[model samples]
Target: MTQATPQAPAFQLHDEPGHLIRRAQQIAVSKFHEVHGRHVTPIQYAILRTLYESPGVDQVTLAQLIALDTSSTADIATRLEAKGWILREVLPRRQRRLSLTPAGEAILQGMRSGIEQMYLGMMDSLDGTEQREFMRLLRKFVHLNDQQNKPVDTPTKG
Candidate 1:
């Protein structure tokens, strides 16, 4: 009788969905910086756009909306305020209401063309149909995992 040898499992880091998603994010950020320059980061752009649409939202709400932790959101808000791009108002309960300033609006307006170009560039390899399908699937995947990714709400100290 001949002895049988066991084969190694077929596992590849590049083939992992999580790894691919992270790489895609890196490419997106790189493309964003290429178009928008270093003046603002992708996260900051998100915060600015969110505030533009829903102005005067409290810090906690902003954090939830942007899928960020409160501490990070507060830090970003402070940076935006220092840059004169956003205004932060401290509420009675120590919560801060955030809103964009004229400078922030101007920044968004200037980046509009670049934003479109960057998105197009990112998806240039795919056809229109493929792009749409990719986006649809991406949205579905994110939505399905939304609950799992949400930040835990910490109890407030009175």
Candidate 2:
């Protein structure tokens, strides 16, 4: 005789917004990897994309721009540097600035189509209106919860 599956808790994971958001993130990451992992990780792509628009930004600024912690940002930068996609230099006041090398720009150019497809695929489940509304609501959610959702840049001085 086949055994029946055990019942889950009344509060199912699928009904949770946080769980759903995380699942959505996983899906996006999978698509991102499928299209671009051979060339660069998602965070690296964010860094490159930001640098393309705002070159010569400092590490701290770049970290905030991508909503990543400074340490993780630095680590990713190290890997990107090794890949010859970025250059980091220390300036006065111990600030480190990041710039995209020509290689970085070219690689980003190559990945543009894949990136577009990844975005499209991720939102393909929604109709055009739903997609726009979904994005708007997500942005609003972030704005409303930014203080809690966003990582603190630095400790407040006493």
Candidate 3:
């Protein structure tokens, strides 16, 4: 007689950390769009905000600061330039330095209130202490995992 096939362990999708994180991101994006409209995306806002704060940061460095890949950052820069919200200046060696334009600053200022509302709406369900604790834990989790996902300048042969 043939032996019975072994059963595989069950997996719970809803209980997975990645699933929860993705769901949270979806909610955050939805809230952002609701508050800010679809004119600017979350990534675009991040890039705009970073450029506003840093001013004249190179493309690669901007990518690193925003935790985005260079290709995507370049694409976003092109889009922002097209929108007249930012300037991408070419430096020596083909590096592009990004700076937010006056229009970008104006848009950011316009969205300031909505941004605060979006954040408040997202965390409204949590109490003050819980919100702080949640933020702390989230930062801790990202910090612990950051090294593993950081882009390597040179590829390894392994």
Candidate 4:
């Protein structure tokens, strides 16, 4: 005889968002690991993509764009530099910039197709319009979250 499945609690957005986010993150990370055949963190992918898209972006800009602290970005950059995937050049006259070596470029290009395919396959349920709407709402959510994390200064009445 088959065992009965347990029932879940009623749907509640506040109660479910965190669980949903964690599950999605786990699934995405698993899929990425399967595709890459190694343990590549999500931040590394972000750094690689950012460098690939905008060559010669300085570490400061990279940190800001990626929403990482300076020290963490520095550590990541150092590791990537050591791996020979990236190079950091010091410019005495100008801001030091980071650029991906040919190896980095090739790796990113190689992974680009797979990444695109992964996203397309995952979002296959959503049509073009739905996908666009989803992206829009996601961006809105991110912006709101950023705002929420900012310090709020209350007005003082004299």
Please give, for residues 91-153, the per-residue lDDT of candidate 4 as tens digits.
Answer: 776556999999878778888887987788777889999999988987887778874468899
* Models ranked on TM-score: 3, 1, 2, 4
- Could you give candidate 3's per-residue lDDT for residues 50-108 as a string of tens digits? 99899999999999888998899999999999999999999999999899999999998
Clashing residue pairs for model 3: none
Model 1 error, position 62 (Å) = 0.7
Runs off by more than 4 Å, candidate 1? 1-9, 148-158
- Per-residue CA lDDT of candidate 2, range 92-153, in tens? 99889999999999999999999889989888899999999999999998888776467779
- For candidate 1, the per-residue lDDT at 78 reads 95
Clashes of each: 0, 0, 0, 0
Against the reference, the lDDT scores of all candidates come to 0.93, 0.91, 0.93, 0.84
Candidate 2, pairs of clashing residues: none
Clashing pairs in 4: none
Model 3 has an lDDT value of 0.93
Residue 67, candidate 2: alpha-carbon lDDT: 87
Q: Judge candidate 2 against the unseen true structure and give its global Cα lDDT, from 0 to 1.
A: 0.91
Whichever of 3 and 4 has more TM-score, that candidate is: 3
Which regions of candidate 3 deviate over 4 angstroms?
1-11, 147-158
lDDT of 4: 0.84
